[model samples]
Target chain A: MELGQKIENGMEGRTGIRNEMQMSFDAISENEAFARLAVSAFVMPLNPTVEEISDIKTAVSEAVTNAIIHGYDEEYRQENDRETKKVQLHCRIEKDMLYIQVKDTGKGIEDIAKAMEPLFTTRPELERSGMGFAFMEAFMDRLEVVSEPGCGTVVLMEKRLRMAEEADEL
Target chain B: MENNYSENFKVIDNYLMVRMPEEVDHHKSGYISRTADDYIMKEGVGNVVFDFEDTRFMDSSGIGIIIGRYKKISYFGGKVFAINTDTRIKRTLMICGLHKVIEIME
Candidate 1:
């Protein structure tokens, strides 16, 4: 079915939705857990399967972690005296698809292609797996990244939900 | 079976057994890695077993933790084993090419 037609058909049903939410918070380690839980809760109405929910949580955690650990370079933050660096997350649900966007206004990647390579990391000394993008791609139906050297980075991820077993009630 | 969501580590018959929490993501990976490393080095143990029976969720960070532990123990000629994995987590391990290096046991 065409994407637009599917959305239209979905809206006619009781379970269809066109909801969206955006949140901005400090780029701190503790917020990683918060981000995962928030995303999980936001998608609760979809009644996703256990495995599906887990996949979504994991992908969100990776993106947020990347924003905190790699995006805001510590040296840069200190030099500029900017202690309140923030990361933004936007989530939207349209029909059977869930879309997530994580943005960080920190040191952007010079080469996104190289950064996406599995096992490639700039901080190997820190034991970073460098598998963030790889996992996000594997778990989600689609993943995209846009960044500039000094501007910032944004990661967009999309996943198609499997029909919930009890969706009829919705 | 009782479900314990807490992460723990203990020694069983000369093998270090690490009990993972219900969810293994970036938040818990740092603590798990640091604690496991300390135990392995201090105890001078060779073999390590990761108990994932209680783990319902795991991301790539889980893979990285396992691989990191494998590397640490293997440096001393020790082996790493994983147990109690469900189909989904097993598939993740396979996708990350961990099954080729770490032994999975029932």
Candidate 2:
């Protein structure tokens, strides 16, 4: 099945969301960086200002870095046995709202709730502040995490750019 | 990619001075934080002054690192100060409420 088909199958039954786009790439830090920029560009034509753009970029970077550094661990693993793992990102923009899903078929998070806690990290050796989810939550309107042991992990985030009152409050 | 670090000690006391480069971002923040941590331990610096004469960009992560350092040195009765600033970093400092704690040099 195509990558999009796989993601759709994985995300099925959760919500009847549409206008989704899926992008997949081999597990590389550079790829993760590029994915962030691509997602930003994809959302830019919607007319977000430079500050909004920076917030989105920072959130996307945290998400992508988490995928590469925690989800995959391919970079630190032995390169000789490197199996090309992939990080798939699915984005949907509808009705002035943006929903993003980033999934990785590598090591699933041990405790989803704990991982979301601010300043809590399982990979301190890698200098991860465990603040990825916190930043995502701070930047976006909603954040959801779904994972299964030995299966994979998916992070879903939603944000609305048109909420002027909400923006002022934030 | 461009940064300068100097380890200078006072002639009569045990204080270390770190002039953090003007531009601090995700890439250089960690390095500067680590260097400051190590320098404090090695030089037994009582007070740390971070001369932000040329700093342009700093986010929450940078603030976190600074806060971590402040807590680390507080046991020794040492304090941290930020010297100089631009509008951008100043706004970040204000948002993070560091101005209430750290002394900002004029």
Each candidate structure's TM-score, on Cα atoms with residue i matched to residue i, is 0.87, 0.66
Q: Looking at model 1 chain A, which ten-residue stretch has the lowest summed lDDT?
A: A161-170
Check candidate 2 and list the clashing pairs: B22-B54
Compute the lDDT for candidate 2. 0.66
Per-residue error for B2 in candidate 1, Å, reads 23
Off by over 4 Å in 2: A1-21, A25-33, A74-80, A125-127, A163-170, B1-30, B42-44, B47-64, B81-106
Would candidate 1 be rated incorrect, acceptable, medium or high by CAPRI criteria? medium
DockQ (C-alpha) of model 1? 0.55
| Best-performing candidate as measured by lDDT | 1
What DockQ does every candidate get? Answer: 0.55, 0.13
lDDT string for model 2 (B21-59, tens) is 544444455677787788788777777777676654444
| Chain A only: TM-score per candidate | 0.87, 0.78
Worst 10 residues of 2 chain B by lDDT: B3-12
The per-model lDDT (C-alpha) reads: 0.84, 0.66
